[model samples]
Target: MNKILSILAVGMVGACSAVSAADIIGTVTYKGAAPAEKTITPILDDPTCGASYNGKAPTTHFYAVGANGEFGDVIVSLKDTTGSTGASAAPAVMDQKACLYTPTILTVQTGQKLIVKNSDPVLHNVHLNPTVAENEKANEASINAAQMPNGADLNYSFVKPEKFLKFQCDVHPWMFAWVTIVDSPYYSQTGADGKFVIKNVPPGKYTIVANHRKAGEKTQDIEVKDASVTINFTFEPK
Candidate 1:
């Protein structure tokens, strides 16, 4: 009986060790001069939409670089990983306020719910245009739905991974957003401060990727053991 108990204790310890995980923390920055953002003149010309901006037009968010060059809206993730609990994960949200998408860029795992809300007082439509060929089901998930003023939220999800799936407003041509669907839970989008963290990654080697819609992508190979790892990336203006 004692020998059996010892064997069971060893098995328990092995099971505990197998669940060990670490985190990946990183920062994304931009190098060189960022291109000038042009103002969307049509937004100011519109009657209802223009009123939300208080007579000032909004410029494009193509380069969301901070004062110190910290890059925002960049998707940092583990490449080629496939274990996603997105179906049960909390739904991601995108809001339309003042004739613009609150977050011009977003990241969600495959099968995760994306809730789109229109906070504007005018009429708007949520148009999803996915162009990936690898996942036919995801490509067929394209939808164009009209959302009335402060109307009901539109919900969507993808069955496979896709990059930069575009969401545009047909009513307001300048309003747009990009959603990158990752197949793994090990992904994060950099905030305005350009920082991100991917948590609970098991001890192993991984290919970390940082992708920007306009600046392109950067990748690095990394190994994680018991402790967390830090990796940084810099993207130059295109």
Candidate 2:
């Protein structure tokens, strides 16, 4: 009887240890001189969506850096994480307003839903061109569809992992965005303050990778025990 009680106690302790979880929080900074800003002609004279910008050529948001070198729109994700328990049922959105794609960088998990919205009062076509690998010729995917003025949203999902899916509005010619489809929920994008937090990470060793649309990428390996782990990454231009 005592032996059986001891076995049950051991099992309970093991289960408790297996349930350990932690948070990964960090800030991503840019080193050296901030990247140069890029801009495209909004063609405000176009008698269509261009009017939404109020006859102003807006600066491109491809690489946004603060006065202190804070980097925005950097994707921080864990490598080799596989599972589907943390994804939310709520859909991710990419809004089109003023001839631009809001939150120019979007990240979503495999099988997750994405809603693309057009907020302007002009016709715009959302074109998605995914870089196809040599072996994926038969699986190449593309989306070239128009959204009417104040039109219905475009709902989409990708079944496989893709690093960068370029988005553009062929109608506007100046509209651009990118979507990243990941398999794990352990991912985040740095905000205008260059800060990000990834919570509820299972205790384990992981290689965390950070990527910016233009500043390039950096990686760091870390081991998370029962408590939170803080890691920061810096990216510099070549």
Candidate 3:
């Protein structure tokens, strides 16, 4: 009888431990009028790349603001977390379609695989330019590789954390993408609706940071206890 009671108490403790883990959810908003994006006329002028877009040209996506003020492309992450098992994490993918890189801004955990795919019919190059000194060794030495139309995917991973590591195509000077690498899995990117969620965060105090490529960053101290927490961030035009 005593053994049965002990087993039941242990099972109850495990269940409570599982329930203690919570999530962090929030939304990011822009405060001021968003800047107008300029049309990349050169993209439409090119013979090979321009054909992919038919006749219409696409403008830059510097600001993905919605009807209200919800902002997108902002990276929200927790500070001081490290030792990510990103190697086992699902791969993050970036694709080039219609002469442009989709999801111009992306975030991934350190050591996570990044697969770059060429979906366009024309040849394109993947060029990664990482500026951080600590990340130089982890980055690709050649930095530039060409990919034929419908070519095999290009795979990459970074050992260190770096923010806004740029990837560009020299063939299309206007083609660009930014990838931010975090040291842990506790990170989320705001969508077009400006909403984000970081899941399974243990009960603790942390410093959360929300960063925008053009608008800078904001940070706040938070404590996650029994239930999920909500923390919102706002940015203004610089």
Candidate 4:
């Protein structure tokens, strides 16, 4: 009788663990001809920021395509459903340097703290204007006034999920960035190598989405059960 009870206890434990979340790993690639890079000459230049660029116009890294057609700065997220992971405790960081926003694009979980830092020696005001529906009200979000050059860091949290939030500098017209706020913690931005991973997703069926500033959006249906799943996406000219 003792041996039978021990076996039942172990079986229950295994079943419980099997229903837990797992990781989804994938790479984003682009075939065919890559998009040409564009350079922007700072129109509203302050002597402080202009000095860093050394008089040469800065180019946009919007479409960072690699030799193997790897695409970078793409946002990847799992479709919101009944079952999803919780928000992460760690905060996401965005820095402004050399008269441009570093990382260019970023993704964070809704209600998670986002730290925006200005590493430059000039003043910059970070403004967030979210794209929302006509009927819905927008989140009037802005940083603590103009971030005085070499001033303290700015922090904020968005209660609602906004796919793409526009980040711009009130002082500098050319300075801009994009931020994606997701309800679930299963979201990531493709790195320079165009690779991303969403961990701790519950075992179930989900629609995985990939969005790029220029290439637009793509979706794929996937079923995650027990073990890790590998999926790849290709974004090309329409």
Candidate 5:
């Protein structure tokens, strides 16, 4: 009789433990509105512009996912999800191709090396410029490294957290890309559907930072304790 009681007690504890092990997850969608399209002023505006805002005109955002302007990249929610297996994350890849970064959205851990790959037929000098706006040589680091060609990777690391680094090919000035280096492992780049997830987080409270670049960032307070929780975000372009 005592043996039977002990067995049942163990079974109940095992069931409770199993239930507590599930991770939190959910999708982030725009709340009431979508981001507004961002525009820029040209140096010398043509009379064709027919607008009055200084030399500023709506920029011709080339890529379907304009990495240069508002609604540019996805804002990943970091703290909204939590569990045990989230710490000690691995570094992600950020490649340069056709004169631009392959993934418009990039997530990286502090001290993580950024692997800059080049696949241009011509020689390209990878220069890292620090800034929030575009300018000529904004404290750029002209790598003395070999002029990469074909498909070679150049490994670089930032000593400090920069605002945002602009990568350019000195040989091909038109080929420009950007990457935002953050200090945590929870960063994520949202997809076209505007959804993201961070799994296996330990029980705790966190501030989920949603960076949309031109539209800025949206932060939310989240607490992860018992089971998985749900959280979302949205930004209207300004």
Candidate 6:
């Protein structure tokens, strides 16, 4: 009996240790000379496109912001999450302020959640298209503005293997958002100032991806073991 108890205790310790306590953090920025400021088009889905909105859903795209020819609202993620748990970090934000999707590129992991906050008083619909208008990977992931009268927060979990996901406000029709679900917890989004930090990572071989959303994405492999890893990546206009 004592032997069995000892074995169980060790098992529990092993399981606890496997918990990926590491963190990945970073910022998204433009390459080369930042382009002339130009307003992006709203990402609303056209009714004539025959997509399903059900009258209570949002399916439009927000105006897109592009610099260095790379548009905001792009997503990047790890292809495999087999032995990995979802990321451990504050939910990356996709704020709708001034009718624009802030930080068009967002990083997320499997089993993680996204909090949608309405910073503006105007009514807006939060619509999502995982595969976008052309691929149509799936349909109808929505948070209607009318449903949340005041400020609102919504958490979304990604359970499948997808390359990318897109979001928009049907009401405003000019609001747009993007998300990438990585299999591993080791990922980060570049901030406006163009910096990122990944923390507590287990020492091993890993890859880092720079998310440009519409401008496309770039990836780099890294080796780490004991302490934190610091790496920087830049993408030329695509």
Best candidate according to TM-score:
3
For model 3, what is the alpha-carbon lDDT of residue 45? 87
* TM-scores of all predicted structures: 0.89, 0.85, 0.90, 0.84, 0.63, 0.61
Tens-digit per-residue lDDT, 1-238, candidate 5: 5999999988886777554633445554444344343454341243322233355443423222423222335546464332212234454566654344566456554456667766554466777665533222322343434465565677655444443466666654444566665555455666655556665555577887777555566888887775667776756435
lDDT of 2 by residue, 1-238 (tens): 5999999987876776678788899988777787566656656667565565676667777777777878889999898886743246478899988778997898887767788999988788988877744313422332787899889998777766777788889987778889887778888888999998887898889999998767777899999887789999887767
Q: After superposing candidate 4, which stretches have Cα over 4 Å from the reference?
A: 1-17, 43-45, 82-88, 133-144
Poorest 10 consecutive residues by lDDT, candidate 3: 133-142
Q: What lDDT score is found at residue 236 in candidate 1? A: 86
Q: What value does the lDDT take at residue 37 in candidate 4?
A: 70
Name model 5 segments beyond 4 Å from true: 1-24, 30-72, 77-91, 131-146
lDDT head-to-head 2 vs 5, winner: 2
Give the residue spans of candidate 2 off by over 4 A. 1-18, 48-50, 85-88, 132-142
lDDT of 5 at 92: 54
| lDDT tens digits by residue: candidate 1, 7-69 | 998788677666788899988999888999989889989998888778888899899899999
Alpha-carbon runs more than 4 Å astray in model 3:
1-19
lDDT of 3 by residue, 25-55 (tens): 9999998899999898899888988997788
Which candidate, 4 or 5, has the higher TM-score? 4
lDDT of 5: 0.54
Better of 2 and 3 by TM-score: 3
TM-score of 5: 0.63
Clashes per candidate (backbone, < 3 Å): 0, 0, 0, 0, 8, 27
lDDT of each: 0.88, 0.79, 0.90, 0.79, 0.54, 0.54
